[model samples]
Target: MSTVEASAAASPQTGLRVRVQKLGTALSNMVMPNIGAFIAWGLITALFIKAGWLQGIFPALRDPDGWVAKLGGWGAYDGAGIVGPMITYLLPILIGYTGGRMIHGNRGAVVGAIATIGVVTGADVPMFMGAMIMGPLGGWAMKKLDALWDGKIRPGFEMLVDNFSAGILGMILAIFGFFGIGPIVSSFTRAAGNAVDFLVNNDLLPLTSILIEPAKVLFLNNAINHGVLTPLGTTQALETGKSILFLLEANPGPGLGILLAYMAFGRGIARASAPGAAIIQFFGGIHEIYFPYVLMKPKLIIAAILGGMTGVFVNVLFGSGLRAPAAPGSIIAVYAQTASGSFLGVTLSVFGAAAVSFAVAALLLKTDRATDEPDLAAATAEMEAMKGKKSSVASALVGAGRGGTISTIVFACDAGMGSSAMGASVLRRKIQKAGFGDVTVTNSAISNLSDTYDLVVSHRDLTARARQKTPSAAHVSVEDFMGSPRYDEIVEQLKQANADSTPAPAAPATEDAPVGDADVLPVSAIVLNGTGSTAAQAIDEAGALLVAAGAVEPSYVGAMHEREGSVSTYMGNGLAIPHGTNEAKTAIRRTGISFVRYPQPIDWNGKPAEFVVGIAGAGNDHMALLTRIAHVFLDKDRVAQLRAATTAEEIQAVLNAGE
Candidate 1:
């Protein structure tokens, strides 16, 4: 059980580290369940397209045009239609829940949700694993995370909920191949073919036009039946428009072998919605998805960029005029009314997409191949392997930790106090060996010990005289000498005492605090600190602090757009809480506190909000900081105290001691 006796943590500095480890475990858990769904996602389609004919069980399946086989005119895929949703929406719940329960006991649910986000996001829509599962899982995880630490936990389900909106876009994209966006596009295709039917009956438009369409299918669809939406022998063999059906029948634009290649292979997202990019590019029409990747990893994206251009260029050269929409609004669709070479135009379109994508992917995809890192095809397999081992190990460790006195513990030193801090780190390792999961152990000079720390344990020099006056109520003293026999006995005794305690205060029933808190603290504390030589710099310092504390990765500041390239987090009212992401997994982390007074006010946004507050946290922790800080931001007295904090110590006293 977890409990917070008071707001007795030593300082925010120690809390950050524990958060990182917890989230890492969460990442491991989520990846497991999606492994199976992803592999099967690809396989489900294969049975219909790859099989020579409809087998015994598949023959009973419905078709894409008929949801029930009886609703013949409907545009949805009847047979394998639900298969896609099942893969994306339902599988993660089952896998995450089962995996969670089996591994971390109460916390397993939370861990499952944490890891599931990554797993589902790792795959395209077909193996998506909805936020219905992801949201609940994240909430459940946060709850468990709180249970592991003190009662001060935060709820963070909104991220996953927001993530689910993409599913709507995914469904629309899937249907584009079959529906043609309404009857208007269909009429357009027919109008052009009407006179041609006349020519065909009269012996004018060559039967070779049939070859032209097939050629377009080959190139424009950028059909990598090899990767996504492949042929299931069942659907393909059944001749039921449902198998290999998406390949030729479902038209997302006139087939930009270029866009298709990127949809199937390109893997860079400037931000939200990488999987949806395919639909936007292929049908909605934006080829920028290819560019983000090209920019992020030039060597990697080059081949695919060239491949896309090649496929598009070739299609235009061929005169393949698809009456349907072409992404980035290709020449095929634009030229549908243009004249004689429509057949050639269609051929060129297909070839263009295929050539560009293939070339670009081949050139950019520089895997040692021998390293056997299943970049695309075997990605799920690697995840499956993690499910079988690393997840189990991490969970077992976390479970044991939960069963002990500290479910979430932190290790700290100066700078959190480096040497004794190093000692705390060593003890942290021993505790880990004993199977403590998310315990936080930190090291900081005795002066800054008030705002965080459920209980404080320190070596010789870090005594009661130096620390007790600062903050942290629960202090356990030990000698600085690590090798001394007495210190060992004292540690063992504490371990036993903790193990022996009768009904240690049960974790408060209220559960983990929310991840996002827009309101909490009655007053705000602003700090200026970072590596940049200029005191005037105004990036998201809290986010940077979180990264340094091991609470979050450095990528979080960028992900949050807190550091929108040169933009300072100083909201300008002399206030800012730049934040970061713990997107990876749930773990306890130290919250670093510092006070900085710039010699001159830098140009933050035009608002002039510069009394900055920066925060770093797991995916769900920002709200707590936000809410607490917001209250502070509202206080004029607190702002004066923050402005007066000359030394880090003075800042600590004013911000934490008074609060």
Candidate 2:
């Protein structure tokens, strides 16, 4: 289970925290994709602005008549430069388009851009906050309005109706954005900028490290930096030419100090791993490389807090700040974005933070050496658990991989009722087909896991928790339970292991099992050259096919969207299996599956999906044919044929060919 999942099971407050984190994740998603644009603007500011590098190198460039001054948007040239317009117009529009695309699709993106322009024109300040609001609003409003006339539009008039409806909605949203949202967000932005200035003026800004250091260890660094700090910092930078807000979470010193301390005072695997980790943490700017070291000695968080405070204090004393956010917290990135005269201050801040954290961490490590020694493996596991995904750098610290003969394999998930059950059914069939009768496969919730199993397979997000439960078992993590490539790897490993031993008898062949009132998937349900304007539209098409086959009610289609809203159904390898949520089981009239192959991939939650499989399973009735379909997809050559197929019959034949 993930930290969010575990927390929700514990208390309501933690559940609320999870919801807040989700919101942060959503906000971060909007900004992360646009970081490149921010970088471009920063580069321009550092190189061409009035107080920039070129002016320092050649003083004449600072004059109003100089070409450099004209390019820099300074002196008599005013706001004519690319730097001002890019941040004011280009960046926010990109963010708005991305946000709208996330909410709906291409149409939503177009409407979102239109609405964002209104806010841009209305607000004096850069309207980043306004774009974040209006973009999604435009997409959502368009979606709701379209639903009213869905299926009610006549055939040939579809294009006419869609174009006019979208144009009208965009115009209305744009007007609302200009008059209402622009001013509201502008006020919010100014207030936030004022708060940061107050913190800086009072010399109390370093205190923020107390919350920041702890949050970074918990894997909320990206959220805090990109979602909250970047937007606020951008506004501050516009007014003052630099912003200290960007350095708070992006400082690499605190993490570097902890790793250096581990190298000097730590023992065993942690000591051996610390040197390489230090390089990655400091130079590569992957701050996560040192999180396990802190997790091993949680008191080291104090070291981090103190180090952060020291760095902030040094920067404040020097009145130094970055022109833009230095992503990945790398020293190289930090230097790249530093203001023209702030090099000394930035350098000292890193060294000071490193010195403080290293001293504190060394003291903790040396004193605790006798009594604790700190279990590196256990701490690494805890770090991965907190991160909600495996950390390759942390894994290297423990040297965790081991090889042995496997007899029993277990599949685990949070509830073990949905994903785990399906995964277990699929893997069991593979093992049986391989004639490995001695190998026993089962499914269980992570809470019920036992250490007795020889192997445990789980989703990557849940693997850390499963490891805690079954520490002795060799673990394999996968993303998709339906058709993971890992399952095939496991089969291959098992086959190789028994190469020198007596061969087990092959299982007898049986006719493919029946599913629902008809076959698992019928020919008429398979659509070649499948058309969908968006992910949601694609899902609706698949659901419509299922409904046509009498396998599910229309309500099941809505349930599929509900499920997607909570957790995306995107499986890897260009395939996405759209299914109703567990609660929507009643919507299933009988077991059924529908296949739609898109010649051109549609964006399924930012991932390209060429194949969409809509599934409505009634009990275990569909597992057999589902397994066969999964295997067909597992084969790259078969998938290639399906992708190239011209007719629905060709696609159907390719799917059944594996059987």
Candidate 3:
């Protein structure tokens, strides 16, 4: 759900695009984890090559001395240097092992590395493409082969069988890779290399920004940079000591320019927030900070594209390039990776791109006086819609206030391995520092949440599911795992509660309270016997009640569909809560709830929903109502009672009984 996009849900080519995005994500996953190795190799190459900085700094290194030539790897010495062996064997095997591990764990990793060595020795050039193929292929094959004899293997012989089977399969794959895959991948790499050559030779490389800039805003920057460009650029760097391709997607200039323009010419929240966003974008090398700005005014994309072109053109004119990929695309990283004699060109490229983008963005913002200043929160929601995940830093732009203290907190995500882990770590530090060390903060997959925590934090898109998993826990929805203003709010809430002589356990009510301590769901908003054929229709039926209650605009209904398309709002236990995408908060006039009980279960994306609760919460106000709904749904007896209830008052009693 976090990986699926709202805009993508509406696109006719959603399947193809999602598949492509998945492929890109997979490829980046293979490379991003091993970036440190790439950087190490790049540093070695930059300093030890024939015309490298080491030789320029220490002239004796340039001589054909045995040790010098052997270490430098460019002279007549016949020995392998640190640079060549690392690029040729170490990096490929590491990548192969990582890809395998991603699929089948340690066993897959071992087999993948074994198979990759065959391609590494078989090919004249680096075997990155071959490693990408063989690693996953080996893992998949092992998984299938294991499945064949899974239960049949004798208990005593299980280890022996697994070890032998893995070794034998790895041997076969290695042989196959040597004889079959090496030449095919080599030829393909060559063809791709030729295409890059053609573009660089014809001065057409800069034109790639037309695709790059737009794709970046869509959150495909990692795929384009690490998956496609980095490998190609590494190959070029091997031959020429640097590659211009590294700068294509990693350039921060365009994003920085847009932020600077917002700082100078933008209005309202965007203007107030631009300076900090600019700092993060330009210096921190987080290009995502500016994406919301672009989403707010799509015309800014034209500026980004043109700015990217300008940077690329300048780099091309000066034949400027980096020795390696700049991981964060920060100006400092870019400068650190700049090739020898390219300082001027690299500086010019960044400044040139910024200047062009700033100029264009300024003109657009100045001329667009008829429209009111954009809502940073709406733009952030739009950004999340396209990105298919919450952008944590972007959430700070909203500056939303918070309340409540919590003793137990759980950071929940789909897998609970990546983002949730990070969020837990971040919040743990804050809690310890706040002297609330006794407070417990942990992370778990939404599915693995067997026990109730006092507070549950999750992505806004996944809040419904989190509530379903732990109905008693107060839920806080956030966009990012790395950083969120909500963390500070939580800390402050605890401090205030302690000041008021309230224990941490007594703060759930404060955290759960909306604007006022009253019921948000009234009898009028509850509708029984709703009729809808599909999930969209069910969502519409539910959303219409909120509209009629003056809770939201009619446009909010469409957003509910879009939100459903991106991530199923299906909470388990025959309940479906249809809510607008976070960006659709602008459509809400006030907090309201609508409950529609379907006589027959509605097909909600493959899940059957007997009850659809449409929600339009204006702030943290909606969270309290959701917590109440979660509690009722968690009780099988109460759920059964509500299903059989004939009167609206009966349903209300079931929901609001204990609360």
List runs of model 3 lying over 4 Å from the truth: 1-11, 396-400, 403-659
Model 3 residue 140 lDDT score: 82
Of the two candidates 2 and 3, the one with more favorable TM-score, higher being better, is 2
lDDT, candidate 3, residue 67? 62
lDDT of 3 by residue, 326-409 (tens): 888899889878888888999999999999999999999888865766856656655664555556688766543233445678
lDDT of 2 at 404: 62
Candidate 2 has a TM-score of 0.68
Candidate 2, after superposition: displacement of residue 169 in Å?
A: 1.9
Q: Predictions ranked by TM-score, top down?
A: 2, 3, 1
241-272 per-residue lDDT for model 2 (tens digits): 88888898899999999989988999887888
lDDT values for all models: 0.37, 0.79, 0.77
lDDT of candidate 3 vs native?
0.77
Clash pairs, candidate 2, are: none
Tally clashes: model 1: 133
Supply the TM-score for candidate 3: 0.66
**How many pairs collide in each candidate, listed in order?**
133, 0, 1
Instruction: Say which candidate scores most in TM-score.
Output: 2
Q: What would the TM-scores of all predictions be?
A: 0.26, 0.68, 0.66
The lDDT of model 1 is: 0.37
